[model samples]
Target: METQNLGSSPDVRSKNESVKSVDRRNFLRSAGMTTVAGAVFLAGCDKDDDMTPTPTSVDLGSGDVGILNYAYALEQLEAAFYTQVVATPFSGITDAERSMLTDIRDHEIIHRDFLKAALGNNAIAGLEVNFSSIDFTSRASVLGAAKLFEDTGVQAYNGAGNLIKDANYLLIAGKIVSVEARHAAAIRDLLMPNSTSFAGDDIIDAKGLDKAVKPADILAAVKPYVKTTITASNLPTS
Candidate 1:
C-alpha cells in the first residue's frame, strides 16, 4: 500500500532531493560509527546506576534527518529478524503463521526503504545483525521474539514522537506507529486468544495517550539483536 501524504512542504522535499544522489558507502564513512567509542568514554561513566550507557554520538545529521535515521535503524533490525524467521520457518509453524510473518517482513522492508528514501544521504548504513541467541527452530521462541519486536517498535515510536519538530515528519511517524501497533496487536492475539495487545496499559494511559519509551530503554531492549551500537545523541531532545 502506498504511504499517505502528511502534507509536508516543498522545502522539505527540496532538501531531501539534494542529498538523494549521495552514495551509501560515502555516507557511512562520513557518519563514522566506528570512532564513536572515544566519545562514549568522554560522556562520563556513572557506575552507580543500572542504566545503559548512552552512545557518545549518533552519526546521522540532526533535525528531520536524524529522526529518519532513527526509524531506519529500527526498521533494519525488524526486517533482519523477520527475514531470518521466514528463511528457517520454525518447527510446527502453521501456514497462517508463515504467511503473517511474511507480510510483516514485507512491511518492515517497505518501512526501511521509505525511511532511507526520506532521509537521502543522511541515512545510516545498514548495521550487521546477530540473531544467534534466538532459537529459530522453536515456534515458542520465535513467537516470543516477535512479540518483543512489535512491542518495542510501538513504544519506540510513541516515545520519540514528541522529539519530532517538523509537523510533516510527525505525521509520517504517526502513520507508521499506527501500523506497528496493528502488527503488535495481531501478533499478541495470535499468541493469546481473546487478548488485545494494546489492552490493559500495553500502549495507552488513562487519558488514552500512547505510552512513550525513552531511547535508553529501547536501546537496551534491542541491544541483544544488534552488534553495532547506535547512538541517539543527534536525535531531537524536545
Candidate 2:
C-alpha cells in the first residue's frame, strides 16, 4: 500500500523526541511491568473464545514481530473503514468531515506501511474486513463507527505499551497513540459541539489517568468487522 508522509504536528514531534530520550530500563522499571530478561517471553494460553472470532487468520510472527502484526491488523481494519466512508460518503456529511477522514485514512495507511516495513517478512498478511453492516448513507452511522475505531485504537496502544520490551517499538506506539487521540477528539467534537469526547469515564479514570482496555476487550469491540480469528498467544507477555 502506498502512503503519503503526513509531517508530524509540532507538538507531537517534540513529545516524541522527549519520549525517545527517556532511559528504557528506568521507564520499564518505574512502570513495574518489566521482566528481568530482554528476551521475548510468551505464556502458552488457549485463545479466548470471546476475543477470537471464526475468521481467517493473519499470521503476525512470534514475539515483537507478533506485536507489529497485531498493530498491522488494526491498521488494516481502520484503513478499510475510512476508505469505505470516503468512497461512499454518508448523507449530510460535511465537506470538513470528509477532509478530516481522508487525512486519517492517509495517516493509517502510512502507519500500516511503516509497521510492515519494520517487520519485513515477519509482517502478517492483510486481513479482510466486512463493513457491510455500516450504513454509509447515514452521517450518524459513519461518525459513530469512526468514534468507536479511534477510541479503540487509543486504548489498545495504552494497554499494550507496558508489554513492549523494545524501546523503539514503544516509542513508535506512543507517537501513533497521540495521533489516535487527536483523531478521537476531533471525531467527538464533530459528533457533539463544545463537548469533550474523551473526557468521560470510558477513556479516563477517577485518578485522572487514561483508561487502557485489554487486548481481549479491543478484539471483542472489533469482532463484528473482522471475519477471521486473531491469536495473540505469540505476543510477548511481561
Candidate 3:
C-alpha cells in the first residue's frame, strides 16, 4: 500500500515520511481545487447553472509541480466519481459489487492524497466534480464511467512517466500506475465477465504496452466530470 521509495537522501526520506500517514478522506474534503496554467475557474454561479458548474480552465503549472498537479486533478475526479457511485448504489447492486466499488473509491482517495502530500504547497486547490452527466442509480451507467476513468488513469500515468526527471517521482508513479491498471482490469471485468476483456485492444498496443495518453487528451476526456475547463498549456509534453 506504500508508495515506491523516492530515494535514500535525507530530504527525500523526510518528504516520504509525510506520505505514510496521510488521511485521504480528510485531505480530499479540506483541499480546494486550484487553477493554474493561467487558466480561470468559474466562481460565479447563476440561475441557468442549477448544479451545472461552468468553471474556467485549470492551468497546471510547469515542471514537476505541474505534473503533480495534473495527477492530482485526475485523482480528484476519480475520487469524486467513485464517492458518488458508492453513495448511491444502483438498485440491483450486489454486496460483492458494493464492496469492490468501495475499495476502488478508497484507492482513488489514497492516490489523490499521496499526490497532494508529495506536492505540498505546490499542489493545486481541490477540484469540484460535476457528476450530473451520470445516472448514479443505474449499474451500467456507473460501470461505464468507472471503466473510462480507471483506464484513462492508467494511460495518464504511463504517458507522463518518461517526462518525470526525479527517480523517486518516477518510482512513485510506477507504483500508482500498477494499481490503476488493476482497477482498470477490475472495472473491465465488471463490465464483461471474461474473454480478454481486461486487456482490450483499444488500450493495448502491438508492442504489448499499455497506451500512453497525453495530458491534453486526458483533460478533455474527463472534462464532463469536472466543472472547470482545464488547460495543460504548461504541462511537460515530452
Name model 1 segments beyond 4 Å from true.
1-58, 196-198
Candidate 3: Cα lDDT at 202: 81
Please give the lDDT score at residue 79 for candidate 2: 83
Pairs of colliding residues, candidate 1? none
lDDT (C-alpha, whole model) for all candidates: 0.67, 0.66, 0.70
**Candidate 1's residue-wise lDDT over 1-238, tens digit each?**
0111112233332433333312322332233332222223422332233355434334655777777787788888998999999999987665556767777776676677667666755767767687887899976677778878888898899888888888988887877787777677666555553344435465567898766787668877887788777777766777
Off by over 4 Å in 2: 1-55
Given candidate 2, what's the lDDT at residue 195? 48
lDDT of 3 by residue, 15-101 (tens): 333332133223322231221111112111111323534346667898888988999899989988998889899776666567677
Best by TM-score: 3
How far off is residue 202 in model 3, in Å? 1.1
Compose the digit string of candidate 2's lDDT tens values, residues 58-118.
5555666777777778888998898888889877555555666776776666666667666
Estimated TM-score per prediction? 0.72, 0.74, 0.76
